[model samples]
Target chain A: MKGADRSKLAARLAHDVGKYVARAARNMPPRGATPAMVAMLATDLYSLAGGRRASAVLAELAGPFGEGDERLATARSLLEEADRLEDRLRAAEPAAVERGRAIALEVQSLVLDFARMVASR
Target chain B: MRRLLVIEDGSEYSDFARLYLADEFEVTTARSASEALRMLAAESADAFLFDLRFDRAEPGTLVGDVDATARRLFGGDRGRALRYLQDQQGALILAELRSAGHAQPAVFVHDFPERRLANLRQLYGSVAAVASFDARAIGALLSR
Candidate 1:
């Protein structure tokens, strides 16, 4: 059985979302989105801002986590980090967008390793 | 023989898992993600065991990246980052498997004692079972 979890899609960006806080965190005047929610939007941005090759990770790296109340703060912070990470990908001149995907993949592998630790438990 | 693949990094709990599960399943345990991927490629294990932490850093990557991303998100609703990481792992594993050409393989998450299996079932349709990392939980998943 190799289907993706419909309940918990990897968000193509972040993945360590806790259900508790997402449910608990609420907003009166909700911002754009939470850190968890905007992870997907970030994916869209990563794709559109950089284009197909740059945002190739549109499929696997959508991010996750955070709450409704924390959407703006979360989105802003992640967007900042994404920019820095993109800089790393674009190191040594203007790099291809897939460079970010490569970076995301490598990082995701580590995440997978850590996940193995928990599943074993 | 029932086939099961356990991907672990030599945790004490993994040993308990083998002790408890070896009798019931033709258990094949791999200590690394690569090893597990190989076994999965060659075998149709009924279940998969995934852990969200590792000691050895992966080639061409740093632990800080995943850690930083995890901390920023995965707080779930309660701000418990680690638990959030593990839960997200459940989703990622299945996604990778699908990309790799596997059908809907039943997944068992044994890390959360307080976290009910139903919660995962509600969130992730493919989750077969979730328990406090006990043999009984594994058994229940396999039963489905």
Candidate 2:
């Protein structure tokens, strides 16, 4: 990929991940996101930014939400975990990546089921 | 008298709920989740009515010029504010109740985004019963 394309890809990834983080932190019901989901999201983000700029992107998205909010607190914690996991996966072999994918799918299933229930009601 | 807890951040809505339900049920009001939990600990209420959005937003937030991207994602100021509350304090009182092992009392949410009701239920593990701010819904819930 050319320099410009790479930058654009990084930007898009950051923007999309930031939105999901915001949704999970701010809009997702409490207890809705499991630790695995957080980890997976972080992994995706870490890969997209090659672990260096992921943290900055997350901070930009979640930093403005203010300090006392619980959602913000959760997002911050998740970001830290993602950062750590990103480092660990890089140092070791990429094992948790597959597990994280399964967890993400499970989370998606739960969300879909909930959405269906809501639609029926 | 059957006891009722009204968890609303708005004073006018709290007062209206108290007056409206006072004749049939002993209505107690709390302006925040913390207050509501304290009240619950002090006395066992037969039912609860919760306002979806509480007054928990940080000051100086909703006033600034929002970026076009944010506005597109979350809509206007009110929508953004409501989303914040729902994410932070939404269904908190109910979560507390469930955590306390109290049998789910006759509970209803007032003025919540209907679209997100299922989301709340997903977090709390039960369908959210809807309630209006009016006396009629209050009476009906308590009557059942």
TM-score between model 1 and native: 0.38
Off by over 4 Å in 2: A1-121, B56-83, B86-88, B106-115, B119-131
- Predicted candidate 2 versus true structure: per-residue lDDT over B71-104, tens digit per residue: 6656556556444444445365567666776544
Residue B11 in candidate 2, Cα distance off native in Å:
1.6
What TM-score is obtained by chain A of candidate 2? Answer: 0.39
- Kindly list the per-residue Cα lDDT of model 1 for residues B36-123, writing each as its tens digit: 5677888777766554433232322221235555557644332344434443443445445655665534554433433555665565
Worst 10 residues of 1 chain A by lDDT: A19-28
Error of 2 at B48 (Å): 0.6
